[model samples]
Structure formats: structure tokens, C-alpha cells
Target: MRIRLTDVAKGRRDEALPPTSLAYASGEARLALAETEQRPTVLGLIASGRMAPDVGTVTIDGRADAATLRRAVALVDAPDVCDPAPNVTVAGMVAEELMFAGRPSNPVSARRWLEAEGFGAIARTPVADVSPRERVALLLGLTALRPGVEGMVLVSPDRHGGHPAEWWELAESFADRGFAMLVVAGEAAAIVLEGRAPRADAAAGTGTAAEELDDLVAGSGGETPAALDSDLVDDSEAEPATATAGDVAADPAARDGSAPASAAEPAPEPAPAPTTDPAPARSGEHDPIPESADPDPTPEPDDRDEPEGDR
Candidate 1:
């Protein structure tokens, strides 16, 4: 069996998931990077044919049949969709999953199943308290039991806080058992896995799995999708680019630009006034009356007329 997603996307332009394309066939495990709280689940849904992509296609064996795809693929532990409740006990979860698989679901049966599956000690433990590695193994094991399930989309196992290699090995084991596996994880997990690929390849003595893993990481461009980084989106909207003081001062056109100085840049300082010396005082002439000082109100008597009358 083969499953392919061609530019599959969900939500408004870059809201939930960016357009992505990937394909995996039976006996192959692939990883896809999806950050943010909603993206992993969204990708898992689209990959498993549980949800339709807003702008792409998902095909099984080169046929676009949602019903058959849904039947053949299982979406495991998707947040807010099929995840076992945090408060639910391991025994309870096991029993429920057993019932879904059309097997005996009584408490005794659940216990026996747990013991047989090497999870007997954790039977009474709350699912939330289960270790990440054990939790993933148990969930994936149970998912494999479901009838008609040939492939699985495991969603956001990294969120549970285990090393990527732990769960990745489990996925690879399932794939080696002829099940197509797709693990939807965050960018951090993908980076860790990519970094460990060389060591893993050496340990396995065959580079096939590591090479395929490298291809998966490379296909994602090894970077967080712009849409998936909510913080970046929020920051761009919260703080717009503005002209700096240096920019306004250096570019005369910026000062005269349509954007107001108060809005786009700081106002420039006022230029100093030009200085000039007053015309040299005229020779032997009283200094030109000060432009600003007021003249005395009392007037002087005419000295020539008064003296002539007395003589």
C-alpha cells in the first residue's frame, strides 16, 4: 500500500498548515515536520484521510478514494481527537481499544492482554503518568490491532517529551513489519533526528533507513514553515517596520516623504540661524538707534531760541 499527499493543506492561508507533499509505501516510515499546537493534528488528519485538505490531494495506491484510505489508515493519538484522556487508567484505555478491535474487553481480559504485551506493571497507572516511550509503544501496538489498518499516522509524539529516537525506532519497527508509518512531529524533533542520522546509520550497519530519513528531513527544507511559527506571525502583526532616526537623517527624501515624522520617524532638530556682524558703526555718528530699545519720552528744549531771547 502507498499513500501520497500532494500539497495538502488546511485552515486559512498559512493558519493551520502550509502546503506540504510527501509519500510513503508499505514497509516504509517517514517523518513530517509540523509546529504549533494545531498543525500536527491537522496533518495527521489529512494524512489518514480523516480530514480533507483545504488545498491538495491525498491518494492511496494512486487512487483518490477517501473511504478506502480511511479504512486502510489509522490516526493514532491525535490531540483532541483520539488521544486517551489524561485521567483514564491504562487498563481502561486498553479495554476500550480491545473492544474497538472486536476482542474481549473485560477487566480480566485487559489485564491478561497487558501482561502478555509486557505492560502489566502499568495496567493500573494513569495514562498520563505513563512514560513517553512506553506510552507510544502501547498506543502504536493497540493501533496495529485494529482491523483493516495497514498504515498509521502517529501525531505529535514529541509533545509527550521523550527523545525522538525512542519513538522513531518504534515507528521503524512497525514499518519493518510491513505497515506504512507516518510520524507527524515538530521541527525540533525533526532536527534532532536529522542530526542523529549518521550515528544511527552506523549503528544499523545499513544506510537505507537513515538515507530515507534524511530525504524526509530534506524534503521539508529543514526549517520551520513560516505559517507554522505563530510567534513570528504575531510579531509581524504586532510591530510594523518603521524608519529609524538615522534613516530619516541620512535620506532627505524620507523627511519629505508622505509618512509623518511622528508616525514613521523622529523629528529632525532645527538648524542654527545664520550669524552676521552688524554694519560697522558709522564714523562719529551715534550708534544707530537700537532697533528694540524705546526712545526717552521727555523732549530737550531748543537751546538757540532760548539763548537769543536772553541776550
Candidate 2:
């Protein structure tokens, strides 16, 4: 099964929802790791017809409609979404669900279903009494009873406190039976997808399907697949150089509507200043005057007898 989400924006980032855009190609078991509470778990709900995306389209196998999506998607053990009453007995919950769905409502039939799934021992136990992992497993077992479900979305399986590998195995088991699985988990989740590969276009806008889906759930804007592809292309090519305000003000070429050289030429060094002799100090000065400053005033060329005596 293929699920694609286009420019979908929802919820407020300030309130823990960020705008997002992305495309997701589903695997047998896929993992959506999110840093925030908004995750693919919400998308699973939208896909299953429980909630509507504020914007954008949710298509399964290239079709979008309530009846089709509802029939094909199922939520398993999603806390606060699909989880049954904690105090409800396993058999009791199953019987009620079957009755609501217009299926066999007999508690005995529900009990038989549990036994067939190797959960007979917990048939009479209240869900709250079971371990978190067991609770999730039982919920999954119940989900299997729904007819014609082609996809299962498991939300925050890590909250149940078990190896992510265990959840992966469970998802794969469902996939082996031809069901597509999506596991929404935290960054630390231990999920392992079979045949998982890095998307070549990962550099494209939208970080992950979960983040983009949250963007939709948070009521943000969404983009079509084509627009997203274009964004990827734009990102790959280097962006044209842009001058900052200071640069533009400083560069004459920028002001003249012409591109300046990619690299600016270094400025020429300044010439050294000329040296000058200082004036001689006056006779009454207190500070000592240097000999160069005084310069012997041309020695008052004593043309007198001193010249004859020395000669």
C-alpha cells in the first residue's frame, strides 16, 4: 500500500506542532521517529478516517475517501486514541467492539478469539492488570479481528517498555500476512524496518513523514508532490550569491546592477610618511632639548681669532 501526504499544515508550532511537508513510501514495517508529541500516529488516525487532516490530502493506493480509508486502515494500541478502557476485561472489550461493528457479539465468541490468539489466560483479566507490553499485544490481537484491514498503525510502542525489536517483529508478522505497518515512536525507539533504504531525495524539504504529517495535524500549509520535488531540485543547485545590506552599500558594482567579482581584490598598502626635523627649543625652556632639535644654530661661524688659533 502507498500513502502520500502533500503540503499539509496543522497545529501550532508554538504549541508543539511544526509545519511540515514530505512524501512517505510505506514499507512492511515503517518507523516514524519524532522529537515532539505530534507524530505519524495522528496520520494513522487520519488515514483510518478517525480524524480529518486540516489541509492537504491523504491518499491510500492513490485513492482518498472515508469508506475506503476506513476499511483499509486500523489503529492498534495507540494510547489515548485506540486504547480501550483500562478497567475493561479483554473479553468484554472484544464483545463490545464486535457488537458495535455488527459482528458476532457473544462473549464466548470473543473468548474463543482470544484463545485462538494464545491469550486465553487473560480473557477475564482487566486490561489495567496486564503489563504494558501485554496490553499492547492484546490490543493488536483485537485489531486483527477487524475485517479487511490492510494497514496497521502502532503509536508509541516504546511507551510499553520492551525492545523495539519486539515491536518490529510484530509489525513484520503483520506485514508477512500482507498488511502494511507504521510504527510511530520517539527518537530512541528500537524499530527496525525490513528492506529499509535511505531515500535518494531525502534532501528535499520535509524532514520525515511524521514531522510533515504533524505539520498537517497542526493546521499548517501543505505542498503537492510536484512542488516538493521542485524544492528538492532548487536545494541541490547552489543558490546565487546575494549581497548583504552592508556589502551592497559598499560595492559600486552592486549599486550599478552588476555582479561584483566573486572575490574582492585586496586593498593596496599605504606609502610611508616623510621624516621631518624638529624646531629648536627656546633658551628659557625647562625640559631638556635634544641636540638634533638645537642643531648648534650654524655655530655662529666665529670668523674671529678662534679660527686663526685653531688653524
> What is the per-residue lDDT of model 1 for residues 1-311, given as tens digits with 9 covering 90 to 100?
76777777788775888988877667878887778899989988988988998898877755677998899999999999999999999999999999988999999999999999999999999999999999999999998999999999899999999799999999999989999888888878888899532221122224364353443444455654455467557876898777779988887877787554466567788765456765665454345568798866774655433344332
The per-model lDDT (C-alpha) reads: 0.81, 0.62
TM-score for predicted model 1 compared with the true structure: 0.63
Best candidate per lDDT, number? 1
Task: Count residue pairs with overlapping backbones in model 1.
Answer: 0
The window of 10 residues in a row where model 2 has the poorest summed lDDT is 197-206
Q: Give candidates' CA RMSD values in order.
A: 20.4, 17.7
**What's the lDDT for residue 28 in model 1?**
77
Query: Which residue pairs collide, candidate 1?
Result: none
Question: After superposition, which runs of candidate 1 have C-alpha atoms over 4 Å from their true positions?
Answer: 195-311
**Model 2 Cα shift for residue 139 (angstroms):** 2.1
